[model samples]
Target: MPTRPSLDSIALMRQWLLLLVLAVIAGQVLRLIGMPAADFLGSMLVAIGLGVRGARIRVPALAFKFGQGCIGLLVARSLSAETLASIAHDWPVMLLATAITVVMSLLVALFLVRYGDLPGSAAAWGLSPGAASAMVALAEDHGADSRVVATMQYVRVVCVVLIGAVVSHALGSDVTPPQIPTGTAPLGFTVPANGILTILVLTGSVLIGARFPAGALLVPLLAGSAMQLGGVFIIDLPQWLLCLAYGALGCYVGLRFDRATFDFVVRRLPSMLFSALALIALCALSALFIANLLGKDFLSVYLATSPGGLDSMAIIALDTQADVGLVLAMQTMRLFGVVLIGPYLARQIIRLSR
Candidate 1:
């Protein structure tokens, strides 16, 4: 549906301008409420609302791909050598937590497939305990309804963020996000040389993965991770750039929704909500046992295992004074694990369910 675009520049700007204005308003309100991935979710919800009401604008494909690449780099920032060392040191526990998460996600997927009549790939990827945006992109690559997957993933993200905040509060800590000094150069110090290099890495990775399945996201993630682990350079995406990426991605998923997809989501809203809640509860129980076994602080282990977006969990971890490194390490582990095996597991779960 070129419901798409044309060569007329003024017309194109006219179409996008209204959506952008609304998105900014929604995003700011959501951010003030401590909502997770506020920019992405606000834009997405606004787009979805417009789509259902017959809006006709869509994000260009190139823009969306760039957004995906930036998300990959954002994730890559977490994978430092020290983080890897901590993960390797606690390999058994880390693996146990990852395995439990994968298995539980599949079971939730199976339930949705068998009972809710949802597509298997979307269900599995939706429940996966990883970065929500990355999982949404991967689900799209592998033939799932990205609209459904995005909705499910965000639903669980909301659940995880709310519960994580409550747990952090109960444990005697404020749940406000950790603050960064304004206008500070990325990576916490001035490194304009490496900042330029980081941009090249992001750009090259995006171009390279443009044609590969989920490559736009995965390539930058792997490349950025390797670069960081080797001390070559830290990834240096500023908050404004990341907000732009999230906004593009949000619009892309949102504007593609048709009346039929909208109807399906509305009809299945209860099951989606139930599935998200059940998944969070199960992960929390597992985290309790694992924390005791590893003799780590419960809040630290719980946030690590929670199936929320990395940024949200990271905020909670920093605010709560939890072990930030371990939190990031486990989150990154589950994230990569989901990217590698989530699709295959979706197929297997579908087969077993039948």
Candidate 2:
């Protein structure tokens, strides 16, 4: 015999169900309208509205990690030998562009602290273009304001997606909605063999990556790239699985912004918005210089340097048929760089703000 759930528990379960239904509905609606990152943006909007309405819903922690793992596999499967070769050939430019982007982010954080009245530590983490969930978690650990950090990170994501869409539309880029995989494998082993190997590598990496910060995503990505480049196998994830991954990620992010979180930083939203736009503009200018130096097109450079999540940037690159390899290489390099040095820099900024 099982014990009965309490009233509070039952209420929480209901809230979770309601959240899921609304998120899916919103995501489908957004997809139908041809929006970039439709699942994420739509679910996020619904979650935000519900959160602001005083609903007590929370996304399970494992849900986020699972979503990250799926995205990791998707990106890893994309890495080809050509992509790696391009990064190697343009090593100097990649390093310089990544370094410049990080420095620019720091400068914007400083501006937020001095002029926008945000705390230095929070501003530092908030302005970072690393994975938003990771940044928010790290900010909380470093005694920064997690609420503000989350707000800044998501605000930038929304802006980046919308702006990227508009730019792609204006330039007559791909701008197609993300869909399930629908391509054939190159001349290689049987389909089942390749699929098994891909799943093994993806699962193994996520398990091993559990010990590292944001390792669940990063590890699989690296492992997948290595396997693909080595010609050991290929990855072609199914379409339905990709959709589920997108939904999970979007819903996870959406559920995090509850009413109290928003109210805490409501007054500073305008400043945060301005600071985010300024940072983006500065990064775009830097991309132009790098593009000219390397003879690469401006769109690739801009997307590579744009301050957004690695997953989001990869999606935009795929949609626009931009240099997916270069964008991934640049974004992956920066993600590692920031994860390594961001905490120390946050500490420095906090001291400077004193």
User: What's the lDDT for residue 279 in model 1?
Assistant: 82
Best TM-score among the predictions, by candidate number: 2
Report lDDT (CA) for all predictions.
Answer: 0.75, 0.76
Give the root-mean-square deviation of each candidate in angstroms: 5.9, 5.2
True-structure lDDT of candidate 2: 0.76
**Mind giving the per-residue lDDT tens digits that candidate 2 earns over 1-354?**
985332233477787777778877887776665555666667667777766666676777666666677777777666667767778999898899999999999888887899998889889999987878778888888888887898899888767766765665566665564443333345566677777776777678878886677787788888877776666677756666666667676666666666666776578888888888988899889989999987888888888988888877776676667887788788888888888899998987788877
- Highest-scoring model, lDDT: 2
Q: What's the TM-score of every candidate structure?
A: 0.72, 0.87
Candidate 2 residue 330 Cα shift, in angstroms, is 1.3
List the lowest-lDDT window of 10 residues for candidate 1: 177-186
Which parts of model 2 are misplaced by more than 4 Å? 1-18, 177-188
